[model samples]
Target: MTNAVTFKILEDIARDLSSDEITFPTFLDITFQVRSALKDPNLSVEQLAKLVGAEPLMSAKIIRMSNSVALNPSGREIADVKSAIVRVGMEAVRTVSFAVAMEQLLKSKQMQPFENLSQRLWEHTSHVAALCRVLARKLAKINGDEAMFSGLVHDLGVFYLMSRAANFPELVNDKAELHALLVGWHDNIGHALLSALGSPESVLEAVRDHETDREISTVSNLSDVLYVANKIANRSSCWRDPELDGAVDTSVLDTLFDAETLAEIIDESEEEVQSLKAALGG
Candidate 1:
């Protein structure tokens, strides 16, 4: 499938999914699945414990991961499922599990066209997540772990597109270059899909309004985080958009960390990506 057709199918899927009045049961199912596979973004660590503990499998995984040598910085043993979730935090738990758990759900024949696409998407999202953290701490002088998580999942719309390709072969066959073809368009699509899936308003808004002009309506801070995080994606390759270079809507851009700080963060993120590439023998 070419890139053009993929986006076309995505548009159709978006329209069809949007037009269908999702029933309460369906809504609840989506909510349950998203929640079950991951923790609530708004829930506190203690709250995450109770929520995750409700599901035995997730709790076990959480506990095992907390006891994993890599995540447990201090190497303290977790006593319970809740404690494990609290120690790791909801997004971290969600990040670890969602990618692992959703695999079977997203499997299909058309997924072949996207062979390695999903893997690259994960790598890109993870890098963007890391960049978001770097930007938040070094540039904005703020904690952006949450921002990093948001960045990590922002391009999930593309994943949904791949999943739907089984149903829409034209979309599966889209042939254009990926970045040039669908950049501005996918935000609304992502927003609607995740909203239909019962994500929080902040996440939806970040997806839907991330690219919307402020004159149309001011974007939320979370959207700002996504916008800049995406803008700096692929180690500043996306930032060369002449269309957006001098454009207004300084709301997020102004609040973005200073240019010098951003430069440092970008350099560091490049190093991180390179290190990851080297680790993978790239």
Candidate 2:
């Protein structure tokens, strides 16, 4: 395809998003409701269960996650949505719901042509999210659950670009060219989508700054956690190209975390990472 064709795909993506012509999955609608309900301190367990149970797929996801090795130490399975909600807590439920929503979005017919690439990207995001959870708990002194949420959706722009590219057969047929196109525009598209989706300021900020080289920023913020976690996850990801190892940066580890502490965190995170990846359908 010519440069004109490539540019048209980019323009369509922008226009579709701006005009709200892109139809995201219905589960996202349900997820937003559950997320909003979880924020109310006064929301009762019964009310919370009702909110979650209204969506059967999400309820199953919550219950299944509640019974995972990471969350359920007793080996007992949760048979009901309410019990699952109580066992996993509000934040975790929100995380799992979002994961389910994204999974549903990835399976849409529009993404059929790029299923392989989409699934690969989801795995990469899941790894970053798992590492972000560990980093926040071990170093950032922030909410680990929120950190994972931020990591999970960090590549919303890339996924959006991929989905948009599906409409243009020329783009999907050329992997290298598609990669270059996505890398060039995902950050901006991701920022806009997050804002329109009503993401928290901290989450939006972290996603916006995650790709920037803020090597000089001294504040131990979520962006730093995301950056370090993203790099570490990239290094270990299955989708990572072996030839790109030299391009990976390790200098930030010393600046963002103590060597001994970082080691311990990674050591402790292996099991949790596998458990979370499995839960998210990675």
Candidate 3:
């Protein structure tokens, strides 16, 4: 509709976020609980198993991930929860837990009306996450897993907006209309939601700043990696929207890594990217 009307809708979305009126999928609660609990330095494998075991689906996913080709290149498969946790490491478990939680979130009954849109977003997110990991590892020498995690949740705002928009079908019934709202506000709204959810500082900054065309900080960080990875991922996939291409700042490639090097890196990581995407069920 009108710009004023759109602004009002965005304001309502912000209010819902602050008021905790917007609901996340049920599995996220368990994911958060386990995530927080895992942060305890004194937590033992037995205690970790006990905590994760409470949720059968989470436990199963953890085991499955532990056996994935990325982490467990060895042929030995992990059968027990304790072994799975040890095999995957706490950091990986935390990341995969959220991935599984997101899968549940996407499958929620509320998402049925926007299933096609949700799936597209999820696929884009998965690609971004894979590319982020590769970029972090090869270019920035950062923690690839953590970068991947950041990439996975970078678009939290888009999902939040869609779920809330489900409350007002008139605003989102048309695909073009909903996309316009997402393009306008997803970054700001994502920043707010991630802050509320206690996301890491690196991830929060990356997600909030990735879309902007700006100079690099004194030193390279995850944000730079995210911006580059997001562009590369979009280019490699069909998700790149022509209308939004000009919004990206290509200069980051020169400051960070040359386009040729970046493309080669992405090309080399094709197998790894596909494997990681399948692991995340992208």
Candidate 4:
């Protein structure tokens, strides 16, 4: 969807989301916990380890990556959850948190009219988050950690749009119309939603103005980073949209699109995604 339509949805759903407690799906509990853990670096390694193990899927990933060749130390062996969590750093835990939370967020609620929308949303969200992290790091000199969070949460407006769309299927089922509306309005919705969530100025700005830049000065900002990251994420996905591709500048993006760098990011992101997918035990 375009920024305009996205923003409008955000405005419409303003009454629905209460940031005070940050209501989320049951599946999001672990994600919230992990995010909390990330903020508290002093959290006991053993306690955090136990916390990670509390979720079998995330626990396995912690162990797998800790022992993998990518982070190969002289004799790094993650025998248990605690070792895995400590070795990977707290923020890494947050990534798993997002995946787990998102999984739960997508679980179909009996009352929700959009039967399978949540599931599809999360699948798309997770891939977007991964792509954002990779693309931002590659195209701009953006930090991976920031990219992780921005990519993960950038589409809160879309969530609201989808939920609302359930009540108005005719308005949403059409791609062209929805995309046009979104481009013109999502930024506003994103801006408001992010503001409600107490996001940083940088994040809020990025949420609002990510689609296009009025001046060259703002291009170096996180908003631009996410804007571009969003495009890259979409490109990396199976649900390819030709319309979305037209919004980006090929020449500028070409310099940043290096095969070697993309390969490295893809390799790591794939490993993480696969590991998480495995943890689901499918």
Q: What is the C-alpha lDDT of each candidate?
A: 0.54, 0.76, 0.74, 0.57
The deviation in Å at residue 176 for candidate 2 is: 2.1
Q: Model 4 residue 230 lDDT?
A: 60
Kindly give the stretch of ten consecutive residues in candidate 2 with the minimal lDDT sum: 238-247
Per-residue CA lDDT of model 3 for 174-222, tens digit only, reads: 6666677887788988888777767888889999987887766422579
Candidate 2: give the clashing pairs. Answer: none
Candidate 1 overall Cα lDDT vs. reference? Answer: 0.54
* Stretches of model 2 off by over 4 angstroms after superposition: 16-27, 35-43, 73-77, 216-219, 238-251, 254-262
Between prediction 1 and prediction 3, the one with superior TM-score is 3
Model 2 TM-score, 2 decimals: 0.83
1-282 per-residue lDDT for model 2 (tens digits) = 645666997787677678755555354676667767877889898998897788877787778778877778799988899998889877777787778777887888978877777777788888888788877877778988889888888887887777667777877787777777766677787877777767789989999887776574343678888888887776666343334223556567677657896678778888888787776664
TM-score of 4: 0.62
Error of 3 at 117 (Å): 1.8
Q: Pick the candidate with the highest lDDT.
A: 2
List TM-scores for all candidates, in order. Answer: 0.61, 0.83, 0.84, 0.62
lDDT of 3: 0.74
Structural RMSD, model 3: 3.2
Ranked by TM-score from best down, the candidates are 3, 2, 4, 1
